[model samples]
Structures are given as structure tokens and as C-alpha cells.
Target: MIILGAVLLIAGFFLGITLLTTAGFVVLIIGAVLMLMGRSGRSVGGRRHYY
Candidate 1:
């Protein structure tokens, strides 16, 4: 998710697409939150890992 977000962000920026940039930022934030929760031994969506 993070990687995808980054790619989208870069692509959006280069292509001048506002929607993709916004979506990418949101996705990146969500992925980071999930990863942090997993590392803290928390379950996300009933799974130990979000991946």
C-alpha cells in the first residue's frame, strides 16, 4: 500500500493529476497507521497483520 501510494503520488505530481495525489496521500497515511498498529501487537480487521 505504501509503495503504491508513493508511486501514485509521484505519478500524480508529474502528470499534474490532483485526484491521484489526494488519493495517494490518504492511502499512504492509512498504510502507515496500520503498520504502526501491527507493530504494537494490535490486530487490524481481525488480523494480526494488515498486509
Candidate 2:
């Protein structure tokens, strides 16, 4: 999800799409939250670690 968001952000920057850029940022935040939750040993599937 983060990778996808990053790709969208880069593309948006080059294409000058304000809406896409904003959506990309929103996805980035969501990805970050998911990553943080996964790293905190509270994720649904299993315990995980973040480097």
C-alpha cells in the first residue's frame, strides 16, 4: 500500500494532479498507520516486527 501510494505521489507530482497528490498523501498516512500497528504486536494475523 505504501509503495502504491509512493508511486501515485511521484506520478501526481510529475503530472500536476492536485487531487491525485492529495489522495496519495492520504494513502501514505493510512499505510503508515497500518505499518505502525503491525509493528506494535497488535496486528490481527500475528506478531510482527518493523525494522
What is the C-alpha lDDT profile of model 1 across 1-51, one tens digit per residue? 888889989999999999999999998998999999998999999999888
Q: What is the lDDT of residue 31 in candidate 1?
A: 90
How many residue pairs collide in each prediction? 0, 0
Q: What overall lDDT, based on C-alpha atoms, would model 2 receive against the true structure?
A: 0.79
Clashing pairs in 2: none
> Residue 46 CA error for candidate 1 (Å)?
0.9
Which residue runs of candidate 1 sit more than 4 Å off their true CA positions? none
Q: State how far residue 1 of model 1 sits from its true place (Å).
A: 1.0
Q: Identify the runs in model 2 with alpha carbons over 4 angstroms from their true place.
A: 44-51
Model 1: which ten-residue window has the lowest total lDDT? 1-10
Q: What Cα-based lDDT does every candidate model obtain?
A: 0.92, 0.79
